[model samples]
Target: METRKGLKPALVAAAVAAAFAAPVEARITKIEITSRGPAFGGVEFPGVGAYERLVGVASGEVNPASSNNSMIVDVNLAPKNARGNVEYKFDFYILKPVDLSKGNHRVMYEPPNRGGKTFGPFNRTTGGNDPSSTTNPLGQFLAPRGYTMVFSGWDKAAGTNTANFNATITLPIAKNADGTSITGPSYEYIVMGNATTTSYNLNYPAASLTDKSAAKLTRRARIDDAATVIPATGWDFVDANSIKLLPDGTTFAANDIYEFSYVAKDPTVNGLGLAAVRDWNSFLRFNVTDDSGTANPLAGDVQKIYTYVLSQPGRLLNDFRYYGFNQDESGRKVFDGMLQWIAAADGLNLNLRFSQPQRTQRNRQDQLYAEGIFPFAHQSTTDPLTGKTAGRYDKCLASNTCPLALEVYSANEYWVKAASLFHTNPAGTQDLADPPYARYYLMSSHQHGTGNGTARGSCQQLGNPLNANPTLRALFIALDQWATNGTAPPPSAIPRLADGTLAAAMPQSGMGFPNIPGVQYTGLKSTRFLLNYGPQFDSGIMTINPPATVAPFFDNPANGKIYPTFVPKTDSDGNDVAGIKVPDVMVPLATYTGWSLRAAANGGPDGCEGSGQMIPFAKTRADREAAADPRLSVAERYGTFGQYMYARGNSIVQLMNQRLLLDEDAYAEYTAGLAAVRAGSLLKDE
Candidate 1:
């Protein structure tokens, strides 16, 4: 009962404040109503109470404990001008002992009904057709419940700005049942869009309407179609030799130069030109000059570089050569040399280079041999000094002076090296580790020239052959994490298959050798043959024509012997040759399922089982029936591949853009390259 005494004065003060704040503007202001109140006060405006109790208050009655009742307020704001065509209505509730200092407690209001028709534009339509009736009974029921409501125009010109609408509603609180004056908080509401000039006098007829305009709509392109079409405005392919001088006569000294080369194989279509390759070269550049116009090359300098090298001259563009690397040993030495020279001449470091070779060849006798086809073929031959095979090499083989080590360097390695240099220890320095890069990954069982091996068993069926090397997934994850997080990723975070679980571990070297009959040496051999040795001995021996192609043979399919036979074929030298046998390994591609299969599998009265085997197989009759159905759409067949591609491409672009923003030097170079491509002058005229 003591609580009632405290509420009366608070309600009176809130009412006084609302009366003063209402007339400051004649135009309506929008307000959002919510059921909850701000901290510090339990009071609500437009208080709530029983109908009889409120009636008693209107007649100046008294009830000491009545402060606990709720009150409802009807807000009405009439346009001041005689020509005013809009009226604002607001309804809200107030809790007992209202706090005037805090804003009014607000409640959401529903629109009113006119002749059984809802007042809003959205309620008038149904499924591309006009509904048979547009009546809203809910709105009509609230009208006689002591609630005030009105129709108003959301006109922009009537207000100071385009955002604020021309009209609003205001509610004033009066005395309550106990002869105690009730204070009401101020309230406002505004809607979006322009309203026509019209007045309603309760009995006025509804305005004539036109066909309602629809909201702007956008449809996603077909996924398969999108994947097949080349990008129109974003990055495309470029050429290795496409770099040319800017039309504005920007000349570069030998030291100011950057060269990027790569062998790009056009797997899509062949014979592309400079024009077709320029789109991808467009990029943003930043940070080459200081405030005083001095040339300063900090770690962040950025520029866009684009170059593509096809299999043949003037052919379709395929791969890219982006020349942005750290000044380290693992990167192109020639490029680093050029930058040093440029820095000495221009007082800034400007040298950078990147290259991609279609295939690298190496001399077998060299101490630091470039890993080529031959070493792999001869991997079974062991060196007496070291217990390891001659062809076996580790990550640091090139620097270790191993005679059998062959390093097939790539441009991606240089990018990784550059990224590591900028982000890792000895921060901001260009010095990079030897081989300044990481490992080269060969995927197992992947298709479309990706690699051969089973990457994961979870997606495998009965016939799929599992890949032995499981660390490939981890390497890629590491690369992405390194690019995203500055911290060097630990090998454990990379995904790998250990036992049955997906785990992370270091990548193991690929073993290429296969044991064959009569090949005295055994162990890992090259996946592909490198050479054809002549079969004959010395000339002084008895004159007998020698067989051609003296390569070692495994078991003869006919006799199961080591002897070579000309039955398969013979070369010009008359040496016997055996037919090459391609491996017939069955690799798992992807799995397909239907909605019907899912429904049937989960249709039991009991809950679904958690065991892997408990899940039904696709070969079930129900699954087959679902597959045979013709009504299934092409989208159903592809699963989410299209969506996945779109998301992946977007992610790649986002990452590149973010990197461009962070690295000034790289961004500048990228922008310059883009500009050259845009001007149709990236390639030399000759």
Candidate 2:
């Protein structure tokens, strides 16, 4: 194969971390393109010419991320590669340069964000089946530059329909040396809707049983809540392979979780799910072809490769890096650069016997498992609670294949997730220097989901309407520049305990918050601690049946291995002061919080999961006097469009000066925010 694409020097990530690696090399067997078309309804890309979206299947044999032989279930599976040769179909969208000379022959692997149908991929901003021609958040701006955009999914438990969902890799079943099927305990937390639906999909196949009584199913209102084991729980076999909940005497309530531990058979090798992303991208980026039969899709046309996975997929990236999957089997690196947003403390729980990559740990509801294990930060950390030292990068560092990376977080992580532990010690300070190859940014006063500020007053407070996507958009370009061209990104901005920006959290008072009548403080924050989920948990071999947990699993005040929880400190207005202070924080509009109380209809009022709140300031002093609001009014802060625009302008300029806001985003925000202020939307009369 003649090389049309010039050979680029393999960029060593160690400059940010340490060490030097060999130059980049690539290969692929062949590419089978099925169908091609214009994406985003013919919105021409910026630098690249018209986009050509292609769908096809790729097959190859892959090794484990490490020497972890457990991912290959059958001891007698395939001798070619113990993990076996598998084919996974993928739907990819790319652009071929009209003028190849002017294009940048690079590929950006956009991993599918599979957190249900909403967070899945389609190149839409809100993320659904609909593709946005008007507004696509897929960072489509990279398309014009002659970059090949690729998206492949990692969740095996998802539906097999590739047109509607992401691609899935075919995994072989694992068996013992004696050929007898190996079975283990597995659990499921099914969210309720009138309880008549008794059947739930097990993370893995329950060990085939002649008698249904061998399995134990139970029910609980919440994850940490006490449970009542269902003795009368009946089961209807959906085939010899699957089972359904046989609602008999059991009164399954609405919106509650029904759990079951069974002798599950056919434990899917889900850990290979992460490897599928790593291996597929690796094959496409580097390979002419080996006996594995992987055909390069855009071999010579692509020079460099980068991946960006948001929320759920971000967690998959973390899981990927955790296992040293960054360095492929051939000793070549996969992603040259990566961006992980809203990952929180989640490392994908893939490698388990009955792995379900979609098990998200929401507060007071479905939180469980050991994916929230030790060694979260890139650097090694010593757990004060357990005296065990661990790091997430040990494997990556060993192979010198670490990718230049960025981590973006919303305030929701701090108040509702265990994200504070990423920077802080177990029992100590809330700030630490970021690792060499990565940068972490906290988007202050932002929320991930839709919110109604006033419609759900039953919640602890109003929901936060702000999102950090604007800032994420700016940083996305910065990451590309830094990865492709070696341009340094802006310094990370996170809340610090040393600077008093981040401190301990409290339920209600002590933050100098003004008492807003009728608005109840959530009086809750998500707990984070190192947990002992029994012996076989982390290794994906569960020994404690049903579910294994420590004594403090249900205790609200229990601390984990090393530390309690830490939160961003707040100002007198009850808004956090740390992280990237965008226009909203610099210019006054509403006092936004990283936490929101779920309405009775939403989260049942306890700890309303991880939602943010927005508390708008009074319009005028007259309104404050009538409402008896103690906080300063919007009019008191700024009068008219001129005043608001002046402050907003200054804030944007200051953020730009501080390198917190990119110049491009700052300018765009100035225009858009000024227009909003003029239209009386941002700074309102009411």
Measured against the true structure, the TM-scores of the candidates, in listed sequence, are 0.19, 0.85
Each model's lDDT: 0.18, 0.62
RMSD in Å for model 1: 34.9
Model 2 lDDT per residue over 253-283, tens place: 6666666666777665666566667767776
lDDT per residue for candidate 1 within 155-229, as digits (tens), equals 111122212211212212222345343221110011111223111111111111121111011111111111121
What TM-score quantifies how close candidate 2 is to the native fold? 0.85
Best by TM-score: 2
Q: What shift in Å separates residue 241 of candidate 1 from its native position after superposition?
A: 26
